[model samples]
Target: MSFTTFLKSVPAFRSLATREVERLSSQCEPVAYPQGQQIIRKGDPGDAMYVIRRGEVKVPIVDEHGREKLVIRLGAGEFFGEMALLTGEPRNADVFAETEVECLVIRRKPLQDFLHKHTGVASFLTEILGRRLLEGDGIRTVGKYRLVGELGRGGMAHVFEGLHPQLNMAVAIKMLSHELVYDEEFASRFREEAKIMAGLKHENIVEVIDSEEAYATFFIIMEKVVGTVLSRMIDTRGVIPFDETRRILSQLASALDHAHTHGIIHRDIKPANVIIEESGRVKLMDFGIAKTQKEAEQEDEDIVGTAEYMSPEQALGRKMDGRADIYSLGILAYEMLTGRLPFDSPDPYEILRRHVRDEVPSPKLLNQRVPDDLAELVRRACAKKPEDRFQRCADIVKFLQQDAPAAIDLSKARAKVFTVIYDPEREEQVTGLFRRALAEARKIRGARISISDMNRIY
Candidate 1:
């Protein structure tokens, strides 16, 4: 398989684009080992993880008396040594090749360095580690809901497919992890999201059915959706068709428009959180992490959302609004059209920096099939500054449907275009010309610009 294809084969790595997988592949060195060779020893320092290209490796359990017992067997495509990467701990178990093995080995320092920089990778790792740290067996129920099956888990919560005892309605129950429930601040945030979601009622969005703390566990129940998430669809299809992308975008924009009208900001709008029904209908999920207008104002260092889809303000940990969601939707729109994110890095921190400062290349540059108008819309939506982007979801819908009127060019209106000259003699004239140009531009826009610029146009 190709390098990118190999990475996508791993469930955790599927969300990453081909270019990102290529970059990661560069850090890995191919190595081989023969049968019975000890690859990792218990208590040894771990600074690297290896993905098996071929052969089998067995993790053995050893008693204090040095008796060995076979615990689990890992084969081609499986990874080992992540415990060290996640927790900085020594190897917990000894791994020996059960057969001749070839693997791609990525060293710890380089991997951790990359992980520290990329928010998406960090979020993925958190989910993986969270699962490992929590019960591997899993919880069967929470309060009134009897969990029929597990849906998914993240750093702070585990979701289960469940049903209410009295109502018998199908529901998805999200229980705050026991380890996190004790954190008053985190619990408050969780509760706040529940309350905010409870207030919203929209068909395009998942409905929050109920929330409560029972038997020391905090859980929220939402309408269960038996459909595939868009991210998984992207993984299987590589790139979504423009028509389908447009359809999904329209539905999602409608959902956001409704939520924004209700004063809620999704804060996270990646493909992973969008569900596509069997009938091709869209249902936006995971309001358990959305922020409200009131909550958005609180100053805190805590950051949320998958790093790849974060708006500039969200990545910077600054206060956010509905426009932040607009920016995130732009990123998703880009991915839907081009099959990749506009910005990527081995360091997620750089991704945040770029979101706040870099320009998003047009979608047509990556995919010839993307129409120029759609590409331009994506560019504007993903603009670095909130004021530079489409101000609302309604604007996006109107643009997509070709019903939008001649709209304001927010960038020129909000920006000062200075014409600098070397001649010191005409300073006053140049300054006067600048004032006249500014005045005319403002008059044409029908809005007063509270901007000040000394330089004038020629």
Candidate 2:
């Protein structure tokens, strides 16, 4: 098939006017591949979306162990790289020629320009996107979580409200979107996120009960609650009451602090990631884009974060840390107190650009009702330079608890570490009122080594 003929058959281009299709065809660069040639590499920057004009190409599922299996094949009129091209993200999979193949590659800029002018083109792609392969039969079960109903769909996964068959306990099941299961890099990351969340146990962090790599999908079971996401509250109430905001901030800060201590940095921390339970408990959810201390992925054209809450380093694709999360928390705090972001503008990209170079306005300037001290805290927490922000997320909780009772000051309540010199002959099982505080002891050749830090490390 010729490039124009293939475009005509593509559902997205089918709706386009003859002139528009011609324009796209003129902008397309015809590319050819011999049988078994590698086309797209997973994790490489995607600059264009490709349409198959002749022959076939296969997307092989490659595992972390370096094994590969053929997952899907594309023929004439079919397209790939839509997600990468649309979001300007790295390629999520590897494509190889199944046979001698010919393709028409439309670069991102021209494709974006065309998409802007032809709105229905996006609608057509939406239809293709919504067609998840395994959803055809409707997945009814994954591991022990029996799916009751669909809770919601996120960018990369579909969440389901479910229950345990035996325990009869309520749970939320999150499954990686079927389409992404074939993209092993994404699938591995999806599983890794569950592992990270599983390691985190805190009152303010959502609990991960289980994670499984089922035959058809990867799913995670988590504790569920009947309540609303914080985003909805902010939407309905404009701004949260100052006292309520402080309480919520304390919980969120603690959650971030705990994760940081555990060597996890949640790259996304907008209100939508926070769930407010009926019991008034705050549960931070989703570590989908989080980076752990051991993650070796380099930064540079690999920016991945929500634009509104992105920190300066995140927006610029620079190295990030727990301080990046602090910046996001400040944005969340400012929004809760002022009912608006400090970097609001008509253009979204400009908002991101502002976070990189613009100064954060004092929250009090937006709402006089905001306390001056709180306003200053917000400004400092959101400074463009990470060093200017709160050095630790625990500091945010400490700042909020300044007026609380001395007992509520977590720093004062911090568990104490002690140096215990013990001889094998003298050791007769130690016990005291500090039993709970008596953390770990390392058994040496003839004695025990005292814990330098308590068991409650976080």
Top model number, TM-score? 2
Model 1 misses residue 14 by how many Å?
Answer: 26
Which ranges in model 2 have alpha carbons more than 4 Å from their true place?
A: 1-139, 405-458
Candidate 1 lowest-lDDT run of ten: 118-127
**Model 1, residue 92: C-alpha shift (Å):** 36
Q: Please, what is the TM-score per model?
A: 0.57, 0.60
Give the range where candidate 2 is weakest over 10 consecutive residues by summed lDDT.
439-448
Candidate 1 wrongly placed segments (more than 4 Å): 1-141, 298-300, 403-458
